[model samples]
Target: MKRAWKVSELARAEIRHGCSSNPRSLTHFLFTLKKSANHGSVRDLNVDADTHSSSSSSFDSSALFSNISRLFTAKSPTTLSETLTEDLAQEVAQLRDALARNLHDSDEVVRVLEENCGPLLRRFAGGSAIVHLLKQLDSRPSLALEGINELISVRWLLGSSFSFYQPKDFNYACKVLNWRRKQEDCEFPMTEEEYAKGIALAGKVEKVGLAIELFSEAANKQLRTTSTYNALMTAYMFNGYAHKCESLFWALKRDPNCSPTIATYNILILVFGRLLLLDHMKLTFKEIENLNLSPNLSTYNALITGYIRAWMWDDMERTFQLMKEGPAKPSTSTYLLMLRGFAHSGNLEKMEQMYELVKDYMTQKHNPLIRTMICAYCKSSGKERIKKIEELMRHIPEEDYRPWLNVLLIRVYAEEDWIEAMEKSIDEAFERKTTVQAIGVMRSITTTYFRSKAVDRLATFIKRAESAGWRICRSLYHCKMILYASEKRLEEMESVLNEMENSNLSQSKRTLWILYKSYLSCGQRNRAAQVIGLMCKHGYEIPMTVLPS
Candidate 1:
């Protein structure tokens, strides 16, 4: 009788008052309804076919709510709040399920609604729903590939503005530029112009990979009277090609034009250090000492990260201590690598302490990602100890805060089920024009498109990226050519090869093989001969082939 009276009373509120406009009043009324429904001895109500049908029909819901309401009311008042919380949670869960079902079955409805949502829904779609929607359309064949192309094109143009960088921004900027460029042209070859741009970027960033390309392009063409072999050897070593580093080091020693530098020894030490081939590391260190080439800060960090990887924590600490006493002091990367290692090892205490120690420097250094990363970790663990971290960051001055903080804040609030919090952050961010960061924010989308063999989208992105000014031409070239081959587009590959030849962006031995396969795959023997002719026109040697009679 008590449960029946409570249900009728709650139904009476919904039928008359429904949910109110005022938040507090609405919360109370909703809470009352939840309590009334949940506190009811529901198992008995569900067991009775007539009562169950009558209540579910009244609520315009399924038997699920009826059954759960029974469990909540059967519990005591101390458990009442907990039980009511679970029952209320069901409202949100059902909404999510309904949204998903609508997206699955009502494409036209979602399409029309999402377009009007402006950028927020676009980000949500690109970030979450886009890939799933593509997968669903896979069996539709007519729509699947085109749908992905549309999704990626929108992604390619998604950002608001690309801005100037602080010192800490370079790493992230490079990652974004790299990701964006690859998205547009995973198989686009770096034009000689693009390679030149990369060389300029090397001067700015001191990225070892770009340095290797500069010397490789110079040496492969035998362009200068000056020796490039030593530079290539140094570059190969630094890039962690152990055998190539060793071979090139020996090759340079024999060549009169090139000689060893202290930087060379550091590279050699790093090459061996990374393998944690303790014997090789020691040998290189001993050799460097003999040659009067002192190990630098980076050399030590390399050894430390390597030791950490090998679970030689003692050696890692020893290396750290040695850095303190030696010519080199530890940098943030040295600490970040250690922190990541500790994190992987599941040492939360050490991770926390290291994070706190790095906090001030990371801020001064303008490394906003560390804070966002910490927030992610905290959220994953469901720890409210550092609740609303993104909100707290807003108190800092413009000098202290990064422009990307809004993006981070919205993402966190969305993931936390703090719907009210998410709405506020998102509205603020949109008003502030945060949609720009979502553009190519995910490199995985580009990777997915590449894997799926989408060339036009890749080409479109590369063109956009060039205008935007990324510096990873070699990476773009490597991927773009692969995309061509994947689609069995030989003429396109041939055209790129011709462009590469003209610009002097020499293809590696592996790249040449890919080109050859592209030619054969397209059944273009004559075009293949033309490629050989084109190569010979540039004085590149071609094996003479006898015509089969």
Candidate 2:
């Protein structure tokens, strides 16, 4: 009778014999390892002679363990604990390979690895591997942070000295949550920096409500610092709550613990600029000086941006002169903003001058600058537009040249109504998998095609965009339905709805309204009534004017 082999031995045997190539087989072995690791011992693994005979090519369990033990042959005599550690280390390397391969069930594999492999991880996995695992869980930041807490728990239970000292590891933790440990476990306190990073992460993921909750919690905990307040205010300002940002700024001023920084004033200026509160923006700039805070590059840029937004050419130029004289030198962003302002102001002379200045400061990585230059020329007249665009095109890096050229050509061709040229440019962008995020420009092109009743062209363009995974705006579908309704092509009209549904686009009040209007305009009162029913089903309040008798 064959002696009973250990679970780890069987796992190594299977992996060594091609089971690792099968994702399910790999997941099973990992699961087994996790179970055994958690139980503090490998279960006795047995294999029958018949099973072994069925796969004559397979290595026996003993042979696999023998190969692994040879790795430690040159070292001192190993104890059972050292042997277990070696086995756990090998499991970690396998986990890394499994993740790196990105199997179909890799996400599920990641969840299992995090939830079940804590002991093995604490024994063998280093900080970098933990960080990699966290990033692999990037789609779920909450879960990523929980993995860290799990490792911490395992460390405490094992009485191991595992610590996260790397900046990247700590920063990622902060981004997800303001985590703290008990007083006895080398406590990490709730801090303003932690709150700031957490809030920024929330904002980045568009979880503004969560950001607010974090800020409120910070206030309740009396962890309100200048950086924390600044971060929250920025989230508010960028998410179209500029008024809330202004109110927060005043509250920050009143709070004795939170002294406003230059960043705070910079955010305030931007808020005022966006709100068109030019007087308030200027007062804030003046207040910065009164507070004896030396204006930084960001301060001047914000002020200039405010001037540019309000179309105050004289003031923008004056501020630019001041920025040039002050300690804060202009950055590439300053010149790019100036270029846009000048182009819109129709001061091509000044635009060209700024373009030269921009080129001197800009690098190949400044693809946005190149796009802006092309857009600026598009707003101008004459062949010089093409000449300048081509000139700027030469400076774009080889890697970025194609995509940038596609966007630039789209803009130029769209402006000139070169339909074939525009379509070709768009096709190239999609083919290269660099679908342009120029939704507004695409809307304009689609609207042009729709208005002209170019149904074939419009359908082709929409199909191409959808195939390339670009989100088709709802308005485009509605407009198509309207066009089909006008033409009395009821079949195509309803097909638009089907397309929207198939794409997982939810029906909205506007969608129902469009359908109701379409059916009613087509003299199909019964279909119109069905749409009103859909509206009711969707919980949209029907307008009295659209109600059927």
Candidate 3:
């Protein structure tokens, strides 16, 4: 007890001395002083040096000295210093115990860190940022947050982004109603404002993973619907996680609370189609049926498109046969695809037969699309198709310029040349209003031009397309690029390549190809090699043939 009093007095004296040199020291001194007041629990025998003394002789000697001192003892006053010393000792002990307990990882620790970046973050920043981003990319209207609560009416709806987050135009009434009911106490899950803002943020950002996480978290905490799931599933699929997409389908099936709708299977089948996993895709058709779900045209269309692109003719024919025989009806797209593929393959007879079938199925109102297909067929067949072309032209709806443009094909086919297709395509394009048919019809014409020798018309269309539509891009543009280069109009080729540079569309392989060819034709080996580096920087895998020599 005497030693503790001395220690406190010394510390105070040192603090007073250092206060002139450092003001912080005085503050620290005051903190220690406040702790010293509580000394009720201080131990009287506790002293510094004799804390572990155990010898009996030493203890007896100390007791004799203590008795001798008491005979002539000088009484010392108890001081505040002793109290502070006792309080400081207790505080240090408590601190050490607390440090030990904190070493374990626990939920509280995780929770504390996550609270900032977790639900609160989504609530504060996610909605507006997301909606803004989506509006920029797709130009689609943003969903109002208040309108989204209607999606959360069911338990499974909880994990979806759309339930808590949504497009801007969704009904505000249902949202307010649901929002009002969502509270634990207030009967609403989140305030209508929070819901709106979170969804808006979610829609705007490109970080789909974060969006999914935020949506999933919100969904788990409340009710969710299948529509909510579909939205998230779409986000996943768009990001190219095909495996995740497939799993989502089965997830719907396995969950007692969730059932896979036709849309769900359609999404799964589309993934398989994209992968060219014919066996897996074919199974999805049966799987949907076995699950007592009726397959929609979208489901059949995905399979048909997949087979057509893969050139799985046997599978295509079988699926088409089945579609024709069953409740499913083939749309114009079905016939158009068959026509397009067969035309590309130079199977003129099969092309003619497909065109005739389209004529039989399409009424006068729906026949323009079929006429577009038949015009494509006539372009491919050349002179033999002239008669068919004339008959199909008579059926073309008013203001459709397809036949006028295809006159080039009439010429080439009359001479049994493929180049006429391109001329016909470009010429006819001038007469038609901009529509989906215009592009396809143009492609059919140009592709035939490539098959023939219509270089002049091909270049014109390429130039026109490049000038239009935020710069013409797509597979067709690349095809046109190749065709122009192959014809060896070096000056015109470079012009098109330069136009591509300014366009929104970028496929580095195409860029590299044009760059390499330009350099090779100009005999600029040094420039060509540098372009090789540039291509690699843009993630273009240089072809093995063009690697060096």
> What TM-score fits each model?
0.31, 0.45, 0.37
Worst 10 residues of 3 by lDDT: 26-35
Local accuracy of candidate 3 as per-residue lDDT tens digits, 1-549: 446445544543443232222311111000000011132110111011121121010112111111111111111122222323443444334432332243233233223323322332233221222222221222211323332323345443444533443434332222322332333352113321233223323323323543455445545754233333444554455456677766765665665554555656666665676567888888888887797765545566667656754667677678777778887676544565565445444577777777775554444433333444454554463555656665765775655444333444434443444444434544354445332244444455456656665667656666666554312445455555566666665566556655656665565676667667766776778877888888888887777887786
What's the CA RMSD for each of the models?
33.0, 23.4, 34.0
Highest lDDT among the candidates is held by which one? 2
Q: Write the residue-wise lDDT of candidate 2 on 432-485 in tens digits.
A: 886756777777777766667776677777888888877578877777777787
Model 1 C-alpha lDDT per residue in residues 286-381, reported as the tens digit of each score: 786786656665467556645654667677678888888987776555565455445445466666666665544443222223443443354354
For residue 55, give model 1's deviation from the true position in Å: 52
Clashing pairs in 2: none
Higher-scoring candidate on lDDT, 1 or 3 = 3
- Deviating ranges (above 4 Å) for candidate 1: 1-230, 234-242, 255-259, 272-279, 290-292, 308-312, 348-353, 363-385, 388-549
| lDDT computed for candidate 1 | 0.42
- Runs in model 2 deviating more than 4 A are 1-186, 360-368, 381-383, 393-549
What TM-score quantifies how close candidate 2 is to the native fold? 0.45
The true-versus-predicted C-alpha distance at residue 470 of model 3, in Å, is 26
TM-score order of candidates, best first? 2, 3, 1
